[model samples]
Target: MTTTQPIGVAVIGAGMAGRAHLAGYRAASTMYDAGLPGIRLVAVADIHEPFARDAARRYGYQRAETDWRAIAEAPDIDAVSVVVANPLHREIVEGLLAAGKHVLCEKPLAPTVADAEAMVRAAERSGRVAATGFTLRRSPAINAVRRQVTEGPLGRVQHFNGHYWCDYGHNSDAPMSWRYRGGPGSGALSDIGSHLVDVGEYFCGPVRGVRGAVLSIQVPDRPVPLGAAVGHSAAVEVSTERRRVGNEDIATFTATFASGAVGTFSVSRIARGLANALGFEVFSEGGAATFDMSRPAEFTLADSAPPADSDGYRRVVVGPQHAYIAAGLPMDFPGVGHGQNDFFAWQARAFLEQIAGLDRLPHCPTLADGLHNLRVLDAIVSSATADGKAVTVQ
Candidate 1:
């Protein structure tokens, strides 16, 4: 039974990605005309009061909260976006779910697979819509490529080469934070590799095993921050002490999919000259398709049986005809481009749609998917630990 009452929404982080979730929720209703109920920008929460207030004021939320529990306790809040640190996910999510609030959590579900499994169980027992924030899956270009490969035309995907590279950890002076904590495969692999793994599985199929994995740390230690750090930005002031970086800054792995597709994946936070360079190529018996997040508006397609004298890739500009294009933007034309943040809006819409019972098959990744992603990461870590020995995904 769908209610016409406005669905109250809250966000539990006031950092970089949290702000994106705030804007996404504000723009969610405007993206599509699924007769979604009005959304209430109820509250913005962060342990840092000032940040919370800033985000709330910037996004037109009703209030700011320093305590996330306030959101769970509030009767008016129907849904929440948990964008806090990875270690804090399980407790907050469990509390919110117990309060009967639908949740949308950012990726890497938790620091460990065991934690993710517990969260999944909590979501199941609560009977609430628990979604993982695999934001890249909302890209129109990526979805179009997925359709081509999974349906036909790209018949029997044989191989997938994907990489997500960033420069966030290039600066050794960057202060120590939770992002650099945990064991091997917990840093760059979990930070960005999770997205790559999810996309690889989304394109081909579930990863059956992983092998030939390597994890490396570029900067071994960083100065302790003198003040509270937000997101990945380095703290302006730092103490004389330095902490040892416990995880890898770069990760490379080979995966075998259940559908006989082989995948080569790489992720790095120390890749110089690459801000968010996520791109992938899927090769199949019939054809191949490639997409670069840097060029969000288009994809390159190579048909095996091209017309005579034309045996190369052709650029395909995504237009309103593509998935999430029609009614997804105010100007749904081909050249009118969208960015990473627009994905959060699309994701928010999908989450809200599921909450309203407007759709049975949710477009967003479920808690189960999130757990599976962690398992894949665990396999990579185990492989790297065992001298690159093959490790089957649990």
Candidate 2:
């Protein structure tokens, strides 16, 4: 058998997520004794040259570039991580795939259904592995919930309820970024609702239809940055400017999965006092199971068949023995505890393995998943505009 060297990876963003991916790659390299069969960080790319250079130096990459195309077309680059803005996802991913590089893009896939569909076609034509950054699906605790649900422990899934609320964008003075904009898939829906949609589908199945509402509220006008504030050195009158905030800050939807399971989901960026509360509950004939991303280590499983005396939800502790756990790894390791679990490394390793022909493509959220999410998101938006009329997922 011929042994292949580690695949070369290029990350094309220097934002928070880009940093996380870099950290993940470095951690994986260390975990595998710097000898993982097929994966290595070869280059880092960002529009900010200094940030890219800094990341290269800190992450031990051999090269850094300001233009993503340089890394996308480099012969040494086998896979590209698209961590740029949502508007850039389709262009960069399409370009990388056209250049014959495998791609792992962050979520929402693209700003629209058409672009996301194009990305799917490109991946199909390239015959290269393509994965989305739906890291929550790989969580050990969530994996346990999936197993229990699939094993008939949850019985026939009848309903699902979920909330993904955070305060990161709650402050009125939160600076205006791509996330709060209208174009380029900005807004709370694509930014955070995408994850909740992915989570709902990952756990319940395909969402076949939706009925929901989307709303945006303003707390304050963000002050221009110091550099831009020189001309107008005062806080600009900031109100809930609906014209400036085009996308919904709050999204609530009721959906029916392909499996006939009904569900209700809510995602918000302005929920006061909530700091990253992504949670869900599955109710079935057998009982119910609940999960909260904030509390990464445990899930609640309620027994349906009870004598009524000891009937209650039991917390399941995800340990090293869990299906998603890597052998020889500690259960309480920082990565595992923080949801970076082996799953994060597994995503990179799995993509590398697929490219090397060592394994069939492992399921991560694919372009098809992105399409499904987009359709559902569209439905939710339409329903909201039409005053909560039920809308079928197209």
Candidate 3:
């Protein structure tokens, strides 16, 4: 059997997304091998030593480092995944790119528009692969929608509606973290809403304007943590004292696309019983389609606008029609459910290819793409601060 040299890779941040990245890299070799380079799980880094070490052991990485700079400086590491928090992205990404290592940072790019812009500049200067964790772009069913929008059936996209709601912060005693950073470009709008912004651009086109937005602080205060906190819904000790939430809990906005199609998007961290409820619909003159991974392996489409009495959506099972589904499974048909990790593995393959200098695919969200979404998000906050007035996104 012919073999290729393993490309050394590292993952920073041992939190939730970090584990997903580990699994994706591990499975890439097994799931998709065409033009795939040999991969070596080299290291995992986190500020908290225990967390980093634990992830390394579980994921079979060769080393665990408390300082991310160690991974960046390590001569053997060819690429690194920056799964750190939003505020920390610029520093870690810039460092990795400067060290001549390709990097993949998780979404929202950074906490503020300025920070995202700086990261984009660094990526442009580095000339190495720089990608964001926009895993949904690889969704099999969603890709089916993209195919038709770009080629087959759907006429000019007229409107887009997206909702990414969650109940992780519904509890009044949730612990404080950098997620709730106040003023602007923070909270649910920047957290979950950024993904929706990307979705809008994917299905329709770039957002030309954010006409207005309403931001709400539903759960004003949360229990102050006595010590380090874990996941969003994990149990952690907290003091009786409360800290006012620095950002919003719920946000809704209206956007106009470059293609003249308008869109509406909303996100909430406090919506009860809606854990990861991400769903969207695109409407055009001829038809409409809806996709929600929350349902897993299913999407609805009305291929053409029927008579008013017969207008309805038809269930489309994820099958051979969607090209990427075959990569995740032995068969190229629908009804074979797609797990969240499947998307991650698909994303990993593209990232590895870029790092290997093989076939550079078209859809890995670059720092420039991330900056575009950040600009839209920044405009949302700007519009909200001005009391629901119109704001053109730069």
Highest lDDT scorer: 1
**Clashing residue pairs in candidate 3, if any?**
318-334, 319-333, 319-334
lDDT tens digits, residues 22-123, model 2? 766665544432334656778999887877888889878888999999987799888777888888899899999899888889888888889999999998
TM-score of each: 0.98, 0.89, 0.94
Local distance difference test, per candidate? 0.92, 0.74, 0.83
Error in Å for residue 279 of model 3: 0.4
RMSD of each: 1.3, 4.3, 2.6
Scored against the true structure, residue 267 in model 1 reaches a CA lDDT of 93
Candidate 3 structure quality by residue, lDDT tens digits, 1-394: 1225578888999887888898788777766447666788999999988889899999899999999999989988887888877888899999999999888889989887788889999988988889998888888878788777888678778999999999988887778877776655588988888887888889888998886698899787887887665458447788888888888899998999889999998899999999888999988766788988687588888975467788789888887556566655655556767777788878887788777766645448899888888888888988999988888889
Query: Candidate 1: misplaced stretches above 4 Å?
Result: 360-362
The parts of candidate 3 lying over 4 Å away from their true place are: 1-4, 305-311, 330-333
Cα error, candidate 3, residue 228 (Å): 3.1
Model 2 Cα shift for residue 33 (angstroms) = 11
The true-versus-predicted C-alpha distance at residue 200 of model 2, in Å, is 1.0
Q: Model 1: per-residue lDDT, tens digit, 282-315?
A: 9988899999999998999887667779888899
